[model samples]
Every structure is written in C-alpha cells, then in structure tokens.
Target: MTRTRFAPSPNGPLHLGHAYAAIVAHDLARARGGTFALRIEDIDGERSRPEYVAEFFADLAWLGLQWDGDPVFQSARLGSYVHPGERLKAMGLLYPCRCTRAEIAAAATLFGPDGPIYPGTCKHKQVDPEGAAWRLDVAAAVALSGPLEWVDEIAGSQRAMPEVFGDVVLLRKDLPASYHLAATLDDAADGVTLVTRGLDLFASSHVHRLLQALLDLPVPTWHHHALLVEPDGRKLAKRRGSPSLGDRRRGGEDGPALAAALRDGRLPAGISLSRSLHTGA
Candidate 1:
C-alpha cells in the first residue's frame, strides 16, 4: 500500500502555507487510495510545545483531513535516531565537530545548496566528542554509496550530489540527533513512500538520499511543492510570525470552505504562489 506523510514541526501555529502543504499531501494520498499519516517533528525541545501539538490536531481537524491513526512524534522516538548515526559513525563516516557558526562562516569559501558549505574545520581536528556535534563526511559517504539517484514527482530524476553540502552534521551538540538524521530515519521507520514537503527543503533531499544509502533504508519518491507566500512574495514562515489558521478560526471563518478556496486556486487576498522565493531559502 502507498503511504504519504505530512510531518510538521509543532513550533508554532499552523498558517496558510502549512494548510496548503497538508492539503496537498492529504489529497495526494487519497487520490491513490493510499493512507495519509501525520507526524509531529517535536524533537526540538526548546521550541516544541504540547499546546502546539494540540493546535496541530485542531488545525488539521479544522481542515477536515482524515489521517491514519494518531500522529507519530519525534520526541518519543529519540532512540530510533541513534542507531542510524551510530551506523554512520561505525563506518567512519562521522567526526566530531566543535566549530561554531561564526567559525564556519569565517572558514567557508564556497556556497552549497544551503548557505556556505561547511568548511571541514573539525574534520581533521582532535575535537572532543563529549559535547560536540557529529559531522558526516559527505564525500566519503558518497564514495561508499557509489553514485545515487532519487525521483521527485514534479522535478523528475535527481542525481544525488551531497558533496556540495560539505561535511554536514548528523548529531547536534545539545541534542541527540540533527534534523537530517532524525527526519531521514523517522520517514523510513514510518514507511512513508512519498515525502511531501515545501520547496525550500528540496535541497536537503540530496543529503537525505545519501543517508538512506548509507543506512540501507528504502528510497521514497518526493514531491517538493510550491509554497504559499505573503503579498510581497515573501515565504510565509512561522519564524517570521506568519498569520496562523487559528486566527482565521477565531474570526469565524469556515475551515472546509477555506480548503475549497485553496483547491480552486483561490487563495486569501494576501497569499499566493511564491514566484520570487528561492528553493534553498
């Protein structure tokens, strides 16, 4: 059976942009007579809140999206994230990284899919692993994988080139797992066949593909859909304090009616396709 998932980090309220992504995933699964699942990416203890998790259910319920069973949360599955990182480490693909953000910015000379490619400052250093992040040797990983490829429903076949990302972090200093490690592992564990997410994260798929190969996980198809943006074409992100669905709900707006509007390509006055938004933002 086909399975598609909508994994949202419960750091803030669900906004119009989130609504679009969720609707897309839910509809895509239903179209194929498959199952739609919801996953809560609440691994970031600093930002994640229990109330936000409740709000997520409320927003999805308000959207009238029927998902499979209860939502799977990342916080509750920290143990699952460890084995994959350890596997990579056991293969000598991971090294301790004590380089701070400023240190990396000062050392990086080339730009990758996401910002300055991390210059391997700690790759050869004798950094203590006690409280340091674990960095993946991307080049070594690719060497082990021996050329890789994954497909996206919209963009078609993609040649995996995680080298551009330089040595990416697999384990964080404060946390047990990085976004790349936890997300990649969780998707495989949940048996997600189609990964549906925003266009901004499209580049991360390259790194994820490499991880999947290294960990011997099943490959899944991807759909990096266009995003909903503010009137000025700015990406509507929670970090920017984007307006939330709760605002609309509180205003007595009809959830299903709003969903219908979205389906008909009729978005609210201020929200539209992000013509100017970059994919790697």
Candidate 2:
C-alpha cells in the first residue's frame, strides 16, 4: 500500500508552505487509496511546544485534511534514533566532532549544499563524546554504498551525492539524532512509500537515499513539489512570519475553500511558487 506522511516540527505555526506540503501529501494518499500519516517532529529540544502540537491537529483538520492512524511523535522514539548513529560509529563511518559553526566557518574553504562543507577539521581528531556531535563520513559511506540512486516524481531519477553536504551530522550533541538521521529513520519506520515535500528539501533526499542504503532500509520514491514562496522567491517559512493557517481560520477564511483554491493554482496576491534548486535544505 502507498503511504505518505507530513512531518512538521512544532517550532511554530503552520505557514502556507506547510499547508501546501500537507495538502499535497494528504491528497496524494487519498487519491491513490493510500495512507496519509501525520508526524510531529517535536524533538527540537526546548524549542518544540506542546501547544503547537495541538495546533497542527486543528489546522490540518480545518484545511480538510485527515490523517491515517495516530500522529507519530519523534520525541517518543528517542531511543530508536540512537542506534543508527551507534551502529555507524561502530562501523567507523561516524566520528565525534567538537567544532562549532563559527569554528567551521573560520576553517572552511569549500562550499557545498549545506554551506561551507565541513572542512574535516575534526574528522581525525578524538573529540570527547559528551559535547560533540557525530558526523557521518560521507566519502566512506558512498564508497560502501557503491553508487546509490532514488526516484523523484517531479525531478525524476537522482544520483545520491550526499558528499555535497560533506560530513553531515548523524547525532547532535543535545539530541539523539540530527534532522538527517531522524527524518530518514522516521519515514522508513512510518512505512512511507512516497515522500512528498517541498522542493526546498529536495537536496535532503540525497542524504536520505545514502542512509537508506547504509542501514539497509527500504527506499521510497520522493515527490518534491514546488514551494509556495513570496513574489521575490523567498520560500514561505514560519521564521519569515508568513501568514499562518490558524490565523486564516481565526480570520473567518473558508478553510476548505482556501485549500481548493490552492489546489487550483490560485495563490494569494503576489505569492508564487519557487522553482529554484539552490534552496537551503
């Protein structure tokens, strides 16, 4: 059975971009007689809120989207997030890095997908595990995987090139898993068959494909739809204070109508979809 999930972090309200993503996932699953699952990526430490969790349910319902089964919470699966990193560490594919962002920026010379591609400053160093993050050795990982590929419904087939992100984080110093590790595991665990998300996250699929190969998880086809963005091409984001679904609902806008209009390519004035591939993933 085809399964898709809308996983949102409870850091803030659901913006239009989020609405677009959720609607796409929900509609695709319903149209195919598949399952549309909801997942709360609430493992953002203290930045995640309980109220935002409740709000996601309300906002999704108002938008005429119904999920299958109970929502999955990343917080509840904390233990499960650790084993992957541990296995990688044991396999000598992960190393503890104590470098801060400022430290990395000072030493970095090359730029990659996530920016300044970690210069491997800490790759050979033996940093204390207490205050360090575990980074994946992408070169070694790709060598082990021996060429990986994944399919995208919109962007077509892709070659897994996680090296662009350099030594990406597998485990965070504070969290059991970084976004890369957690998201890859979460989708697999939810049995998501089609990962429908905005194009802003398009690059992330490469790393995810590599992880799936390394851990021997099921690979799923992805659908990276266009992102709803401002006229200037800035993607609608919670951090950007984009008008939220809850505010729209509170303002007496017809939720179902809004979704319908969005489906019909009717966006609010001056809003457009970004077609850029250089977005921050």
Candidate 3:
C-alpha cells in the first residue's frame, strides 16, 4: 500500500497555502487508493505552541482532508530522530559547526543562485562550541552515499552532487533535530512512496536526498507544487495576516467555504490556478 504524509510545523495557523498543499496530498492518496498520514513537525520548541498545534488539526479537518492513521507528532518522537543523526555521525558524515550568523555572513563569498553558500570555515576546525550548530560533512556524506538521484512529480527528474551543498546541518546546537533530519527519517519510516510539498523547499530537497542516501533509505518521489500567493504575488505566511487561515476562521469563515474558495480560485482574490502548485520555492 502506498503511504504519504502531510507534515506541517505547528508554529502558526494553517493559511490558504497550507490548505492547498493538504488538499493536493489528500487528493493524490484518494486517486491512488493509498493512505494519507498527518505528522506534526513541532520539534522547534521555541516557536511551536500547543494552541497552534490544536488549530492545525481543526484547520485540516475544516478543509475536508483526512488521514489514514493517527497523526504523529515529532515533538513526541525525539528518539526516532536520534538514530539517523547517530547513524550519520557513526559514518563520520557529521561535524560540529561553531559559526555564528555574523561569522557565516562575514565568510560567505560566492553568492550562488541559492544565496550565500557555506564557506567551510568550520569544516576543518573542530569548533563545536557550547551551543554551536552542527553540519554534515559533504565530503564524508558523498563517500558514504556514492551518487544519488530521485524523481519529482512536478520538478521532474532531480539529481544532486555533494559539491552543491557541503556538510549540511542535521541537528541544531539546542539538541532539536533540524527540518531535514526529521522529515527524511519520518518519510522513510512511514513507507512514504511519494512526497507532496511546496516549491520553496526545492533546494532543501538536496539535503533530504543526501540524508536518504546516507541512511540507505528509500527515496520517495517528490512533487514541489506552486505556492499560494497574495495579490501582489508575495508568498502567504503568518507574518501576513489577511491570507492566514486562523484569521479567516476567526472572521466567521467556515471550512467548506474556505475549501470551496480555494478549489474554485475565489479565496484571497488573485489566486487563480485551479490546479496550481503550493511549494515555497
């Protein structure tokens, strides 16, 4: 049986963008006669809130999306994230990073399409400061994985070479698993054959693909859908209130109304594509 998860970080309210992604995942599972699972990515204790977490479920259900199994919350699955981090560490693919935001900004030189890349300042140094971040040693990760490739439904065939993103961060200094670490592990563990997420996460796919290779896990097909944009084409986010699902809900908007608006391209005014994408890219 095919399995896919709609993992959302419950740091804020589910907006129109969230609804689009959920609908897409739920629709695909229905089409394939598979399972759609929900996972709460609440590892970031600083930002995650109990209220928001509760609201996330209400919002998805409001949008008429359903899951096959009980929703899994990452905050409760700390142990699950540890094994992968240790596995990569055991293989000597991970290293301690001590660069501060200021330090990284100061050192980064070559501005690539993805913005200023890591400059390898802490790559050679054993600078694991008291609260310093950690990065995967790209060279070691590549050696462990050999080479890699994966298929993306919308982005089509995708490939990554280690030279692109050197030693990425798997765990933060605060001991919480980073997004890449938790997502890759959970997808593989749940037997997710395909992943449907936003386009903004396109670059992060490289990091996740690398983790799959190192962990020897099955690589799921990815579909980086287009993001729901505001009238000015700005990405919808909690920081912007008008497009927020929470705001709309409080303003007397029901689930059916919201979902209909999204499906018919009526919600948020300028959102048109009936089958458009929901990626952050």
Candidate 4:
C-alpha cells in the first residue's frame, strides 16, 4: 500500500503551512487509494505540551483529514530507538561528543546546508561526558554504505551525501533519541512508502537515507513540497508569530473550504508559496 504520514510536533497550534502539508499528505493518500497516518513528534521534552497535542487532533479533524488507525506518539516509543542506536555504537560508527554549541561554532570553518557543520572536535576524544550526545561518524558511515541515492518526486534523483552536515547527533544529551534517529526508525516501522513534507527538510533526507542503510531499514521515496510564506516571503513559523489555524477556526472559517483553497492554489491575501529555501547535502 502507498502509505504517507503527516507528522507534526506538538509544540504549538497548527498554522497555515502545517495545514497545507497535512492536506497534501491526506489527499495524496486518498488519490492513491492508500493510507494516511498521523504521527505526533513530541520528543522535545521541554517544549511539548499535552494541550498542544489535543489541539492537533482537533485541528486535523476540523480539516476533514481522516487518518488510518491511532496516531504514533514519539514519546511512547523511546525504547524502540535503543537497538538502532546500539547497532551504530556496536559498529563503532557512533561516538560520544561533549562539545557545546558555542564550542562548535568557534571551531566550524565550513558551513553546510544546515548551518555550521561540526568540525569533528570530539571524534577521537578519549574522554566522554556523563550526558554527551552520540554523533554518527558521517564519513565512516558513508564509506560503509558505499554509494547511495534516493528519489524525490519533485527534486528528482539525489545522491545521498551524509557528510554534508558533518557528524549528526543520533542521541541528544537531554533525550534518548534525536530527530534523525527517531524519525527514520518510526517511518520504517510504520511501513511508510511515501514520505511527504516541506522542502525545508529536503537536506535532512540525505542524513536519513544513510541511517536507513546503516540500520538495514526499508527505503521510502520522498516528496518535498514548497513552503508557504507570508507576503514578505518569510516562512510561517510559530516562533515568528505566524497566526494559528485555531484562531481562524474560532473566527468562523470553514476548515474544508480552507483546505480546498490551499489545494486549488487560491491562497488568501498575504500568503504565498516560496521555493527560495532549498538546501543541499
């Protein structure tokens, strides 16, 4: 079956961009006579809120998106990340790094698609901190996987170059798993065949492809859509004060109608699609 998911973080209410992404995934599944799944990415211990999670269900329901089965909560799957993490560790492709963000910024001489790439300061360090993050030795990982490539419906064929982002953290210092580790494992476990999301995450797919190879997981195709932006071309973000869909719902707007508008490219005033933020890896 062609399965796709709309995984959203429960850190804030759904905004217009999120609505667009969800509708796209839902409609794609519907078009293919497949399944549409919802996954709650609530692993951010400090920021995730129960109230926001409830709002997510209500908003998706209001949008008329019917997901298959129950939603998968990342918080409930902490232990599932252990084996893959341990597999990497066992292969000696994972290392503990105690470097702080400030220290990395000070040492980073080259920047990749995701900002300043780590300089591998602790790749060979003998000392390990109590709560150090576990980073994937990207060069070693890629060499083990040999040459890899993934296909994107929109971006065409992409060569997987995990080294672009340097050594990415597989386990965070404060959490059991990082986004790269948790998301990749969850997608494979759920049997997702088509992964769809915003173009902003296109670069992160490169890292994910490598993780799939290392963990011996089933590979999935990707479709990274353009981002919805404000009139000034700024991408909609909760931190940037982008208006939430809840507010619009409370204002008496019809959810299905709004979804149709987005599908038909009939965006409301002050909203536009932007493709200016493409990233490479």
Question: Which candidate leads the pack in lDDT?
Answer: 4
Q: Which pairs clash in the backbone of model 2?
A: none
Model 4 CA deviation exceeding 4 Å by range = none
* Candidate 3 wrongly placed segments (more than 4 Å): 112-114, 272-281
Candidate 2 has its poorest 10 consecutive residues by lDDT at: 272-281
lDDT of each: 0.86, 0.89, 0.75, 0.90
216-278: candidate 2 lDDT, tens digit per residue:
899999998988888778888788889989899899999899999889889999898767854
What lDDT score is found at residue 119 in candidate 2?
A: 93
In order, how many clashes per candidate?
0, 0, 14, 0
- Candidate 1 C-alpha lDDT tens digits along 9-115: 97888898889899999999999999999999987867987788888888888888889988898888988777777878899999998888888899899997768
lDDT of 3 by residue, 142-196 (tens): 7767777777886677666545555567788876578778888888888888898
lDDT of 4 by residue, 1-281 (tens): 89999999988888999999999899989999999999999989879987998888888888888999999999999999888888899998989999989999999999987788999998888856478999999999988999999999887899998878899999899887899999999999999999999988989999999999999999999988889998788889999888898888888899999988989889988989887877643
Residue 79's lDDT in candidate 2: 97
